[model samples]
Target: MRLMTIFIALLGSVAVPGLAADVGFEEVKITNGAEPPLTAGIWYPTNAQGTSHSLGDFTQTVAPEAPIAGSRLPLVVMSHGGGGWYGSHYDTALALAHAGFVAAAVSHAGDTFDDQSRVLQLWRRPEQLHRLISYMLDEWRWHRRLDAARIGAFGFSNGGFTVLVAAGGVPDLSKIAPFCDVHADHDLCDALQHAGVERHFGSNVPASAWIHDSRIRAVVIAAPSFGFAFGRAGLSSVRTAVQIWSAADDRHQPHPYYDEPVRDDLPRAPGYHVVANAGHFDFLPPCDARLSRMRPEICNSRPGFDRATFHDQFNADVLQSLHDTLP
Candidate 1:
């Protein structure tokens, strides 16, 4: 069966121009945010030539090899941590794409580093996820490339919280008391209010849009924060299967974010994984010498953990979960 699958995959590659080569990465402009339109990188199996171009300078950095074709591929949407861009998880996206899945990493407009406006950052994430999913479904229906039946979401940190929201893990915003003092005209305060961060939906975007979206087959969260407030009621209500993976030594966010609360809640839901030695930054790309020199403090958290190995293993686990859960 494996050999037959390989043969069919090779035949499919020959039929499609860039179907069996290394993964191809392309920046797709998605109109989903308030301003500074969201941009996401689409990673998919490509032909040899397309693969070469896709790898480009990333060959030395981190690039994922292509996967065999023939089988119907799943679709995975990746959301990055707070203040992170789509490029931060580029390698992870490519890896999933090469593993016979279409992976898209979105750069939330307000949340990215380039645009540090707190207000927009908080307000736009949910909307962006909703629009992006809608767009992907439309693409699958019209382009005839993606398998709409198998779709999942994977998010890290703030993105992790967003995935919960996408999975119907709605928290009572009132529970998220301000970690700091707030003043009038403060963008952070206003943004948080607008996003219903400490509350629920104040607008027409129904909570059902996430819980009831039949297209989203599964959800995977990494080092999810704010998940504690999204109690069992919210988590248990999700129709789609869920898999959460987190690290015990995550410094940026409290370990309890995963261990005590989130993990405690998962048994009632579906699946979850906890890595012992992992850190918060393990999901991102490997830090280069330049980053170490320029921002030592940031890279110093995970002393001996190998970023490449961690991300690769994490993605592999995610793919396995998707394969088991989704169609």
Candidate 2:
């Protein structure tokens, strides 16, 4: 991993100047289910008249409760990694909003850090994503100003896997046993081990299920989990343009066993990128001082790597990809 870091540093890639806007922010409650209302954070382009403010652990150049800047703007839905909150990619969401996109992200019911009851239920993630999309387009007050035809999804890790499923890739849960057998030390394996495979996938569970949402016109997936589960046949129905990203030094799900196989097997070639000096958690936003002190392992980076610097480039690449693919 360290060697890979040095190799990337030698490549001399640097962040470039790009588009930006004064972002607007809001917190929403989505009542799509009888269980509990879903919590989400929404970001969108606002007239440059609003003041910057902090949202919980992160501060952004966005004003709370600001009015919309433009009508019929593009929309991007975000899904966070396993055990992550909707605010996991708050920076990226803000970037999208500044780039003339309306972005919203929801906290998975039982899959978040505070709850793990339904984390083992593979279908719940995609279902929740689909529900969020439905609510955003049909019930949200700003739905009228959103361009329905130009919609995209963004995700990382397990969230990445969800976007693929929502984009029409069906995973074979039956392959879990064999995957775990080979990747015994992998994080996915350990998660299943603790959850108990039998409890997660019962006898009635089918080998394949359709979880696609036609509303999602494009997707940007990063360091997806359970990539091997989607073989060529499983991804055959996915027709949307996909932007897939992998880290050269990801060890949690790893390159070989998780993300690479998905990119390689997709029916149509995806716009793929491998960040040389990055790790599984690098796709996440750079942590604040308080967050760094609370979680050093997730906040720390390689000797010369700067997550904040890399994200500037990443945001540009993502904005361009969405514009090109969804336009």
Candidate 3:
């Protein structure tokens, strides 16, 4: 009798979708008053028709403010890399939404494209993700349409570091100064030096402040920054399913210091991939002609590598990982 009552209540909040459904898109504000307001872009499944819209570097076709097609759907919150915004991976978010999952990405206030205030403040990113999830499950207008138990995350570069921490991995940021001291000539180290990063950047912050939320069941991290920070000890508490990607020919934060540590340290082997001849930014959505010319460093893949082709498979793989892991 009790089980039947629960089932009936679940059905009451859900709406069945027709055979044809398009992606839905909405930009929402997440403000908790403890920090700056975060502007988030959400993509989800909807029965309404959609039209093409340009969003910064990428274009998307989604039904604006369309009511969700179904109830109790899964959610995947995205975290963009340093200097990136919510639209950085619009294609991935849309793909997830089309596959019946709510995908969202937030523009990290102090570390976004126009603001580099907290670019090196790695400790802050995880809390931003934690807050985003809290809002989606407890405050979003469509909260009841989501299955709180099935939530995942996807991130790249510094954003990769964020998801790792959110999944219960504790990075020993103290390793940064020492690693950079020895490998200052490395691409990532050189860039940090150029960014005016101080050696003791995260020293004042207490260790407990590096936030983690157990709610995230799965994660996809690509070409993570500060990868050396998560040694075996740092990754000891991480219990979520993980898929980690690294660009084989990445010049920015190459092997050994970047993805290698997390790969070898995680308690269990994560689904790992090393894309041959790919660079760090290849993990992002395929760029249009204008963006390609404007930011060749991020847009261009290595010789004989096709980014558009790779992304098709990448997006498919990400969806599959979430499907396999999320209940």
Candidate 4:
């Protein structure tokens, strides 16, 4: 694990230079069904130039210690992929803040590598995302720094599925046949059932919740997991505009998962982009040298795509879409 951490850090240090900026970070602890809590990293543009700020070891806060001048900046709630932490998406968050939006990436209680089992982590992810959104709305209102009407969500992999559900793109968990054989007694299966993923994750929310709530105005999903095909009822329930993008060579979830179903069910308001030679990990900052040294697979996957190039273009596309869509 130590090696893996170093690998990811090295990746970020090397690859992030081209896209990185001075984004400030802060910690916000939210309840995760249990009392003493889970936390998230809130990244935003800073007022100070050149100077850097550090939140703590557990939390990687960077940039100017002072808050920047901005009123009602559009807010984006980001969800990292499986086995990831809030700091993992620093590049994305910083990019968005520099582009003029405040980005908050939640460190899901059960999903992060530090504290939770894989199964429990996967199961609790979607609910955590919703709760985070609800909590952020209140925070935004009180802080008066977020434009509630211009909220957006962007996520990758499992986190991708989180935003999909938030955006009203429902999946039928019962029908989610796993490609790899997982044991029935496995925590993964148990957690999946506990979360009621079949009922909520891929399926649309109730009509009442869908039509009345306007906090989430748009969504962007990258290599979203879960089947892309929306049920007839689910497709009809979607009200928010969406932007979907995926790599042609995504080794993790593949294009078929989303491409086919979205083509048939996604409404006309949503936009789609495909990166010709990208892979799943491209969306994340590079793996640090330590991890890459220990596990080569962590750094480079089955060949073809250049992770750095893919992400550079993907990040630009995401920023552009949000700027145009979010007020």
RMSD of each: 7.0, 5.5, 6.8, 7.8
Error of 4 at 128 (Å): 2.1
Off by over 4 Å in 3: 1-20
TM-score of each: 0.76, 0.90, 0.92, 0.75
Candidate 3 lDDT, 212-271, residue by residue in tens: 999999999999998888899999988899999999988888777889989899998999
Model 3: which ten-residue window has the lowest total lDDT? 1-10
Per-residue lDDT tens digits for candidate 4, residues 1-327, read: 232233244443232211233455667888766545667777776654534443322234356444644667778888887767777677667667655578888887656767555442244566666667677767532356667788888888777667766666555554443522333343334546666544334233333332222467778887776544355555665577778777677765554655446545766556878777666666666555666676464466446766655555566667767766775
Question: Which lDDT values do the candidates have, in the order given?
Answer: 0.62, 0.81, 0.84, 0.61
Error (Å) of candidate 1 at residue 80 is 0.6
Model 2 C-alpha lDDT per residue in residues 264-317, reported as the tens digit of each score:
898889999989888889999888888999888778877788998888778767
Please state the error at residue 205 of candidate 3 in Å: 3.5
- Kindly give the stretch of ten consecutive residues in candidate 2 with the minimal lDDT sum: 10-19
The order by descending TM-score is 3, 2, 1, 4
TM-score of 2: 0.90
- TM-score of candidate 3 versus the correct structure, residues matched by position: 0.92
Q: Which candidate should be chosen as best, given TM-score against the real structure?
A: 3
Residues 1-327 of candidate 1: C-alpha lDDT, one tens digit per residue: 222233244443233222344565556677754566577767776543432342322342223343334345677888887778877677667656555677777888767867656622333576677767777667532235677788898888788877777766655444444431323233334556666564333334344444334567788888776665566775675667877777777765655544357657653555767777777777666667767677565455466777666665676667667767765
Error of 1 at 149 (Å): 0.7
The number of the candidate with the highest lDDT is: 3
